[model samples]
Target: MHQHDRKIRTIGLADVSEPGDEALITPEVSAALATATDIVGYAPYVTRVQPRDGLTLHPSDNRVELQRAGEALRLAAEGRHVVVVSSGDPGVFAMASAVFEALEDAPQWQDLSIRVLPGVTAMLAAAASAGAPLGHDFCAINLSDNLKPWPLIEKRLRLAAEADFAIAMYNPRSASRPDGFARTLEILKEAGCGERIVIFARAVSTPDQRIETVELRDARPDMADMRTLVIVGNSATRRVGRWVYAPRQVR
Candidate 1:
């Protein structure tokens, strides 16, 4: 059915199947699934939408984000109820920005009804699993240097360290660029964050999930992989029982 002809509805979905799955999709997201005539996303994310008789799934490779966004916009302009799925909240280093970026160049698609439904992002889920290291001021950084320059990434890391913000690094180490994360560790250490607490939360909320905390001095580059979300606590962050958190107040 065409989106313009039918009322759009959203429902929350439960993620009881795995530890981290619940945060991945909500009932509102699930409800919207029923109204979708087409779902477009990365292959893995699109696979999570489930296959229904009338729903069309368009899964693409990881690097073609702009192209994917354009395709979604095209489908939507054609009257299909398209749901563009991103792993976490689309706005956070995901498809939301890409979609908008595409829309900006193609003004004709701007009038199409578009809504970005929110979802639990990786940093929040990682922080929750480790108490609240992000209780204070924090920043999330995408470590991939594909689109941006390495110097800019380095500059941001230095500034974030100087500000003492808890840093959450996504896409830490991937097969293509293995040394970037190693360099990240070196920069943090040089910025005098060696004694801070670092948490490596991998595949969080999933069956194979793993969480590890350590002093920055002892943290190694190999501890993280593409699936891992790395969080570096501020100087004030500490360990309490099995959890780690930064106090709401600063000295």
Candidate 2:
């Protein structure tokens, strides 16, 4: 039989995981790490995995998801156990789609087994830290326009505001995209959300974690960055004593 004819036994697995304290790492993730022959992820996330003699770690720079996914697929095709890691949920603006996209171009690998392990995503953690600001209807938007156009993001922001859904925005601000979040704040205020609450959860679940709450009117663009998770409450979100929450029933 030729080299390609052998039926592969091992598979590639993708997990949504953040670089954080060991205590925050889920047990299932730990187990997957133990069995993985190769771990591929962004540099910081790959660094988080404790190095073992048998495990090979492939770390790459940001914005190289397709290449990373292809590498993982290749390793798995060789019958090596692989784990493609991502911060937060892989399905939420992360590596899951990239892997599938890579697989589409390489039809021979389609039969290879793949599993996705869920992690505690940032939006869920951010909402919890802010006392359930997402308890009611909410929508998450990635404010980074790297892949999509700015006009699309703007349109979605308008629709979200009109629907009065709590907005959880990822990649709200970055050095290269300084003005995007500023425009986002302006749009919300223009939509009459000045009285609504906004929560900024930065480096959530890590030692550098910081969470801040303020009114939408008072939210400044400088308060957010790549590490921050920005959550804007709906029209009816309110504060009870010291906690900010979205009431279960929307009026």
Candidate 3:
């Protein structure tokens, strides 16, 4: 019923760890935003986007990934250039999957132009801030129990520990579930990983950023927050000068 005749285009934008890393936004993402007709994301994230004359910003509450994704797709279907913003790499526990899920429910938007622009992820940024704790085999886990059960999270922690994989934990602690991370530490300790090097990288790439290195046994649950990305280094992870990294070889 609308008068527009342009092809629908929905560009999903992945974001950096925090606003302090705005300089790290890829050139491709910046270009896409330049022509974006609408930007949709969590309130704080949408605030990161500079306002313009021809653009509309849709800010929503947290935990509404599917709703937000649908809104973006609907906007695009109306011939508006939509950009759905997410934290870190969208493909990595971000908006990309949610958007696709929405698309699956609405086949009308299937033919619309859809693309995901990558950005700096907190895990990689955290790993880099502490040299290369993930230089060896590694895995990233979201400690939040929003989508998955706590028992499953515990099981993965145990398995990852048994595999001797350097683990990067996302959303390690939150106000609503402060004890989740505390239990995570306990599980890791029970799995005989008490001696592993643990890195608490919070607000990385930001002015308030803090990267702390400590042994797993010494790492406190309070050391992490919702903004923190915790990386548990493997047995080979060690401190070189002031940097902590997993050695390239493990023989």
CA-lDDT, candidates in order: 0.83, 0.81, 0.84
Candidate 1 regions exceeding 4 Å error are 1-20
Who is ahead in TM-score, 1 or 3? 3
lDDT (tens digit, per residue) of candidate 3 on 1-251: 34333333333344435565766677788888888888988888888889999999999999999999899888888888888887776678888888889999999778877878877777888888889998999998988899999999999999999999999999988889979999999999999999999999988888888999999999998999878889999988999998998999989
Give the worst 10-residue stretch by lDDT in candidate 2. Answer: 7-16
Answer with 2 or 3, whichever has the higher TM-score: 3
Give RMSD to native, each candidate. Answer: 3.0, 3.5, 2.5
Better of 2 and 3 by lDDT: 3
- Which residue pairs come into collision in candidate 2? none
- By TM-score, highest first, what's the ranking? 3, 1, 2
* lDDT digits (tens) for residues 205-244 of candidate 2: 7668888899989999999987899999998888887678
Error of 1 at 122 (Å): 0.4
Best by lDDT: 3
Q: After superposition, how far is residue 219 of candidate 1 from its true place, in Å?
A: 0.5
Arrange candidates by lDDT, descending.
3, 1, 2
The positional error of residue 105 in candidate 2, measured at the CA in angstroms, is 0.6
- Which residue pairs in candidate 3 collide? none
Question: What's model 3's TM-score?
Answer: 0.94
